[model samples]
Target: MAPMYDHPGEHAADDPIRLLAVRDTPLSLDEVHRAVGDAAAGGTALFVGTVRNHDGGADVAGLGYSAHPSAEAELRRVAEKVVANRPVRALAAVHRVGELGVGDVAVIVAVSCPHRAEAFDACRMLIDDLKHSVPIWKHQRFSDGTDEWVGAC
Candidate 1:
């Protein structure tokens, strides 16, 4: 194997974190894709989370997302963790909050790396950790007049 730092841009790599935000507005896949663009990256992986029409055998009418004050900070921590462990050339993530209809986008994440596998792995880790650890909660309204809360409290 070659030396780790020998990869293009490895010696002068800018902060791998390209973008991180918790927004009440909508997310844009194009924006995330642009943010993670890097000349040295051989592959870029993106993951988008959308509000589906059903969940757990219930018909979802709509949903609203709320975030704690620490949510953005927690998101950054998760992004930083991914950067520290992966050969990430660039990374971007955004989560949307507030009221949203079915089929709305909830989150967007992208990672760029020197190889396809590395990009895929880092992108997955970034999104999974953000979902599990960030202080963003979802209030899902069902067609049956019931509601459920999901995600970190």
Candidate 2:
């Protein structure tokens, strides 16, 4: 199923998790924090993935991301796993596609929990799992004027 947005105030008082995806655009850390905020949450952890100026030992010029049509479904699955395995009060994952330059935000994940430990653990696991499981590929452009397609890195 496609990712759906919950109407404002529509979720149950106890409902405190969310997930999202978007095309190429900058990610706002404040927006992610707000999305994971809740009266019941005491801790929030966020992860931001950015296009680095270098990869491996090569100087990177830019990158382009492409994903399978089922990317959202895979993302949802990963979010569910996080919620099930940890004391997550709220969770979200967003990834950008298309072309990106150095320093562009590639992915953002936020998690809220009753405590700092769980929030930190769940947030890290979410990013690691997403990178491994999501069918998104990146094309890396090197300063040497060569391009190579790489799996999530």
Candidate 3:
């Protein structure tokens, strides 16, 4: 499919793939980055969220992610918003669902822009908005044999 936006000096179809998905499989940073690879872009920014071993002063043994049916669609909306607001060359993001262990990559996002500052700002906006607005929930398993869910569907 063609890129959703075409700016001056940049053909919409000339951009790389724009990925948006929520899946049970492992996510690859390289894959997301590659999707946003654009020769005309002077800067590419990436963000990776890993499963850490702790949350809320509790030791986390592992975690699982659950997504609402609209999670993927919401992700696409978020990406499109970033694209419309920024001079992005290309963008991609993937979020891993199902169970995850400590150090596992939970989410990966990449954005390419014509300038470094724009790339950084857009990348940050994409991730921050995604975390706050996406309908993805986190279930944390504590070392003390308890669990709780974070975020609403």
Candidate 4:
């Protein structure tokens, strides 16, 4: 699919994949928001994923995230896919690794587009694809003395 923008052949310098990272530090909403700021974009959409206290009826006692060496490259690929055939003006995504407590931001993604609907769609696609395809695994320690890994290949 062809890329969407106001000017054709002029977006090479204005790449849409603005920010992509896999960090051990805490994620920031302001950073993601600032990365996707575009002059031409009329709407910006954001999604924040947090570590919840419970999952699948199990009380999560602790959580940690580990990522493969290629996780950042894989994240870039996911972001590219979201901007490939869409009207996305800019996009940013960050996933946190290492130990985290409940209510901590695990992931943050944002997208800017010429319209609200496009921004929403692109942002949704960005986060969904990142979670499913990125080489990041979650280790969950439950209150019942059981532990499990999620999204490990």
Candidate 5:
């Protein structure tokens, strides 16, 4: 199927895929859903990672994220891998940094494909690979005035 948006000089019929990478102040599930929506797409899958109030029974006050400047480049590489491994009609990934309160979205991924199976597979692969390979790190702040640096936890 054709992509909903096409590049200049490229026919919509010729462009079968679309991809986006963003760094947002506050992430939204609706934004992710919109990025992957296309009439030609038969399936869409999304993953959202959020901050929880407690970890291992610890009172989590908040969390902070840090990333190398090359983090966006690395995320783009993962997105490219998803496109290479599946027939993705549209895909988007965004990760937020800085301080976040409990229940805030940390990351979001959306993928659309021609079939449900590939959509699920690609969505999972995108999140898994991103968590494993991305340079972003999180610092968990506990209510006890303690902090821990977690590597993709």
Candidate 6:
């Protein structure tokens, strides 16, 4: 039998837990999107963050991401807040660590809600908060033979 869902405002304990992950492997948007899929959701919003080839007016050669051991735990905490404050039916977020070249997907986030606006708002909140609060750092190698560390917040 199919499971039932909360109509809109009920904080049902049976609501599906949001997906949160940080790994030293390839990241997939398809996986995150699937995680947030729900039969009761009328809208889904996804955000994919990619490693661009430039940073701060410099041509970026490559990049690497590193995370503290507590990164995953902090990720879950951030997602928890999103679920608590938003009208989210499902949520998922994943971040990739290790060496990455241009155009690699660095992070993927998704949110599902009963309405499109809610989904968009929740998804944006999840990603922005994750970026600002998480203890993940980016090491950027510029094409001019210089590098910088950024966003350890």
Instruction: Per model, state how many residue pairs clash.
Output: 0, 0, 0, 0, 0, 0
RMSD (CA, angstroms), candidate 1: 7.5
| lDDT on C-alpha atoms for all candidate structures | 0.85, 0.82, 0.82, 0.83, 0.78, 0.81
Backbone-clash count (model 4): 0
Q: Point out where model 2 deviates above 4 Å.
A: 1-3, 6-14
| Cα lDDT of model 6 by residue, 101-142, tens digit | 999999988899999999999989999999988889999999
Estimated TM-score for each candidate: 0.90, 0.90, 0.88, 0.89, 0.85, 0.89
Clashing pairs in 5: none
- Report the CA-based lDDT of candidate 6 relative to the real structure: 0.81
Candidate 2 C-alpha lDDT tens digits along 1-153 = 234332224445665556566556666777677778867878899999999999889999999999888888788788888889999888878888889999999998999999998899999999999999988999999999999999864
Show model 5 residue runs off by greater than 4 Å: 1-19, 22-24
Write the candidate numbers in order of decreasing lDDT: 1, 4, 3, 2, 6, 5
RMSD of each: 7.5, 2.2, 4.8, 6.1, 5.1, 6.4
Residue 97 of model 5: what lDDT?
A: 84
What lDDT score goes with residue 63 in model 5? 95
Error of 5 at 38 (Å): 1.9
Better of 2 and 5 by lDDT: 2
Error of 2 at 5 (Å): 2.7
Per-residue CA lDDT of model 1 for 19-66, tens digit only, reads 777877777888788878899999999999999999999999999999
lDDT tens digits, residue span 29-139, model 3: 777777788888999999999999998799999999998888877887888899889999888878888999999999988899999999999999999989989899999
Off by over 4 Å in 4: 1-12
How far in Å is the alpha carbon of 32 misplaced in model 6?
1.0
